[model samples]
Target: MAILWKIDPAHSEIQFKVKHLMITTVTGYFRTFNLEVETETEDFHTAKRIEFTADIDSIDTNNDQRDTHLKSADFFDSANHDQLRFVGGKYESHGDEAKLHGDLTIRGITKPITLDVEFMGTVVDPYGQYKAGFTVKGKIKRKEFNLTWDAVTEAGSVVVSDDVRLMAEVQLIKQG
Candidate 1:
């Protein structure tokens, strides 16, 4: 029988990091997101489906001005595109690690992405719930998603890097 799993938001995080000024890195996270998974066993290696969505307006970088600019038409354009989504297409395992192939949609642009996944094991929580953990990492070029906003410093360094690294720690609870 197939089992359904729902992401436990309180125990999950979706974050990204990008180079700034070609020297430092700026990190940010989406405060609201969800993931759904379907599997035939408690072992996530058998997962059959996975889908994720994040609210673009929930982006938080701890800087109000930067956040505002990111939401503008130059970046994510949250006013017009409210959400980003990912649909998993395949799961390829190699020993203890796996690759999740998926289509990610951002700012109305869709592109294929492959995420490196590490299964962190499963356990029964204190609340008597079966929970599984996973760490996912990936990278993407923001410009490919129509986030073309950019600037250059007086030193000729780009203000924001086109490459963004995605990182997530997801905890899923099996639904009854």
Candidate 2:
């Protein structure tokens, strides 16, 4: 039987960064997201399945206008695609670090992506619950996913860079 692990939303976050105007980077986050992992044992290396999803409408950049634009057809197209999903595939580990390969789907497009993960180990919380933590980072090009909306400043600088950086601080609760 496979063991199930569920993300502890209260202690987890998914964020992304993109260079704006080729000068400053703007940070954004998916306020609503969920991840689940299935493993044969307590060892994450034995994980058989991993799935994640983030609600497109819950995106936040701290700027209402930018957030709205991101949800529009130009970016995430949240109106038609309510969520972005990732289904984990190959998992390669080296000591406490690992590479997680998965297919990420956004705006109806799916692409293979690899994320570097640093296992933060597991612990039994005061409430007697078993938990694990990880820090994940990755990069992806927006245009590849059809997020091609672009604008050029008078100086010929792109409004939003094509490259996007992904980061996640995740905590999971092991279920009995």
Candidate 3:
């Protein structure tokens, strides 16, 4: 029988990094997100179904002005599309590394994305909960998702880079 697992929000985080001013990097994170996985065994390599969703409005870049801009129509347009989702399509495992292929939907646009996953092993927590950890990394082009707003500095440097890197440190608790 397949066992269901839920993401432990307190132990998991979804973060992203992007180049700004064509010279510096800016990091941000989504404070609210959820991940669900269904597997036949304790081994995550056997995962059959994986789904994730993140609240766009929970984006925090530290700078209030930048956070507000990110939530505006120029970027995520949180008012119209308040959430981003991912549905797993395939799971390929090679030793301790894996690739998770899925369809990522942002601003209503669905695109194929593959995330590199590192199995961080599993353990029983002090409270007796079965837990698994993973490190996921991926990249996507903002323009491909209709996040085309941009500006050029007087010196010709771009305000933001087109590529965005996604990083996640996730902990999943096995459910009875």
lDDT-best of 1 and 3: 3
Spell out the clash pairs found in candidate 1.
none
Candidate 3: clashing pairs of residues: none
In TM-score terms, candidate 1 sits at 0.97
The RMSD (Cα, Å) of candidate 1 is: 0.8
Off by over 4 Å in 2: none
RMSD each, Å? 0.8, 0.5, 0.6
lDDT of 2 by residue, 1-176 (tens): 89999999999999999999989999999999999999999999999999999999999999999999999999999989999999999999999999999999999999999999999999999999999999999999999999999999998999999999999999999998
Could you tell me the TM-score of candidate 3? Answer: 0.98
lDDT of 2 at 82: 98
Per-residue lDDT over 29-57 for candidate 3, one digit per residue giving the tens place of the 0 to 100 score: 99999999999888877888999999999
Error of 3 at 11 (Å): 0.9
Candidate 1: tens digits of C-alpha lDDT, residues 1-176: 99999999999999999999989999999999999999988777788999999999999999999999988999999999999999998899886689999999999999999999998888999999999899999999999999998899888989999999999999999999
* TM-scores, all models, native as reference: 0.97, 0.99, 0.98
Clash count for candidate 2 is: 0
